[model samples]
Target: MRPSTDHPVDEPGWGPLARYVIAATLARTSDGGAVVAIVLMVNTSGGSGWLAGALGACITAPHLLGPFVARSLDTARDSRTVIAAASLAHGTTLAAAVLLYPHTHPAVTAVLLTISGLFGPLLTGGISSRLPAIAGPSQRRQRRAQGWDVATYGISGTVGPTLVAAVSAWASPATAALTLAAGCYIAAAVIRFLPYAPAPGKTADVPRPLRTLTGILASGPLRRTLYLTVTVAFSVAALPVTAVSSTHTLGVSAAAAGILTAAYGLGNLAGSAGVMIRPSHTEADRLTTHLAATVAATLLLITLTPSFPLAVTAYAAAGIANAYFFAATLAARNEYAPDNARGQIFVWVGALKITAGSAGTAAAGALISTSAALPLLLAVALTIASTLLSLAERRHNRRYNAPCGPASPHTQPENGRPHPTGPTDRIHDCSNRG
Candidate 1:
């Protein structure tokens, strides 16, 4: 390993954040593929649905505690240390999973999965927080980097499972391919040694970062962001449930499922492209409108026809809309939130994501077994909730912006709009001032 540098991370262009994004993408890809193989291997061995669900939860449940682990990123005086330490710790978790899972009992498997999952949020928060430090003074460049990051995530997302599936088909036990994935995590860590900055001076009391995060999440605007994201994330959870269907019951190969998953990712690319291709708008009205439309489109996902062609098509469209929704919510939060709370605000989004995944996964698992359509209906209801909150905010803004009338809480001034000064006659004697 290279000697760590104390270089300032923030710069004018792509640097460590860019590298971190790619490394994170590779790790996620390998884990996802390995998980699918593990799940299938267990099922083929005659594990019951309960066992399958347990294993699935094992894979995801540790996310419930992600918020706590993620908050540790806030404690770091140097993000580089956090990044390096957390990345290697994460790599170790994967290694344990790969080496230990095959020979372990199912109960032990669940324990191993939980232990492994603890690393996920830490890595997620560290990388996310580290990125802003890497790209300086320009939202455009940072957004583009994020887009590339997400795209790589999608690409690996598409290819990883298929690779595992292929190897397993040839090798008799796909689950063992996790050994390869474990190695990939180590590779991710090595890549970070290339170059990255140490984090800035202490911004908050290290001991209380998690508590501070809770307060930030309580803000009305942040609440709205999380609520909307939670709903959207749940809607996305349907995609996985549907893909699993294609893999298991519909006679679709794992490769086909992987491809179908990519289609949704492609849709996400379309959604993200909207921000890049179009003239950007910084206004709240435009942002809310885009978010509302995106959520509305999400409701249509449940309505996709059962056919593989149509289902994949619906999923892709959902991804496009959903991506726009996420970007708008995030941009609006960071743009409008209290400057000091910005880090906390962003951190909570990661927490909400993990929370959403946990809830959505368990719910979807139950519903998918009964009726694949069930998860879709639940998502539609969630979309309605997300949209309603968005529209409510719109109405609130309208009320807040309207000219102060008799019933308005804001007092009208001589200028005929609400002002800090009361509606008094001539506060400043302009006539004689000159």
Candidate 2:
């Protein structure tokens, strides 16, 4: 049986354990990078565009079912075992991909590709579920966990494509991609094997993942968070697809496209440094509204950007907005959680993200090549979406921030009791009527 509660950093498992946490997270990020690398490799090597893109999707497909799968393991009291198994599965798949690449041929490649890719979701699910157990009950720690994950994704997004280029320069693109991906698995194995203070694991009465997701999504505050998150995700997925396409095939060089992409990343990095902003509350609803305005405003500027420098500035601003948006959403999600079903909650949140991202990506695919109106359409849609989110925030703010004398919609009378408001409190006090 696993130990109850998360282990402190000084625990026996703590030394290797801290490494495990950091490395496993970084490994996960690198593995995600590998997925993108593989897609780019496939694309450049005359593979079907759809097929290559689909391969990238294969790696992330697990997040959709990730929460549920992890929940099942939690129910079984086998979280540690599940994570261990997932690590091994991930490593083995990468090894197998490398071994089979040479002799397997294209026909066999497709057949075995699914088998290797399948481990991705399982691994992600396992790692995600065990985090709370490993991190203890601190909110800051939890945010750290999420931040680590985000940093991984952000850095990977920035560096992965470049790695593909570097790898391909020396070896065949297929070989290089596989080699790099396999390296990540090796790193993951080392990280995963490092000792962790076992957690008895989270047990909950909420048996169904969908049920928790549904309940949270049904709540106005959370539902709006999900919607805005999706909006952002969609816009993000679209920008890379459309911006690159328009710049690349139309009139611009790939170098310029890459520069613009870098600008987006820089913006995210700037935004991610949230500690710099004071009085900066992350009450999910308020933060979301603010970010929505920032990003929506940034995107509005996107369509108007005429030069590369202007485009880059706008993209960077958009990224900062996005980073802040995600951070706020996560903070709020955790704050409102019932405590018993956080994993399930985040999973459903993950699903909403996937759904939103997928929808956004699909829409971008349609508009990237065919129309000038696509980016504008996306920006306009995002603005409308943000405005609605702002409306929700107003509602959210009122509920949480109630008035001084009476509980107005602008504020919640905390403790379900309004502040002592009489003639002494307000000039309009009812006592004056007498």
Cα-based lDDT at residue 280, candidate 1: 44
Compose the digit string of candidate 1's lDDT tens values, residues 329-379: 655444433434344455567667767866786688888887756787778
> What Cα-based lDDT does every candidate model obtain?
0.57, 0.57
Off by over 4 Å in 2: 1-21, 40-57, 60-63, 76-81, 101-112, 115-148, 181-206, 245-254, 275-279, 386-390, 393-434
Q: Give lDDT: candidate 1, residue 30.
A: 56
> Across residues 1-434, which tens digit of lDDT does each residue of candidate 2 receive?
23333333322334443554455554565455556655666667677888776656655664565665546543544444555565555555654554564566644545444554544454443455444444445445545544544454566556666666777777766665565556555555554444343333455464577777776655555566677776777777666765676574335787677777788888886776552232143455556667777777777787777766777888888887777776666655554544455555655665657667777777877776677547646765775677675575555444444443452232323222122222121212322111
Clashes (candidate 2): 7
TM-score of each: 0.75, 0.74
lDDT of 1 at 225: 65
After superposition, candidate 1 runs with Cα above 4 Å error: 1-5, 9-11, 15-18, 41-49, 102-107, 172-210, 240-262, 273-279, 283-289, 301-312, 329-347, 361-374, 397-434
Candidate 2: worst 10 consecutive residues by lDDT?
417-426
Q: Total clashing residue pairs per candidate?
A: 1, 7
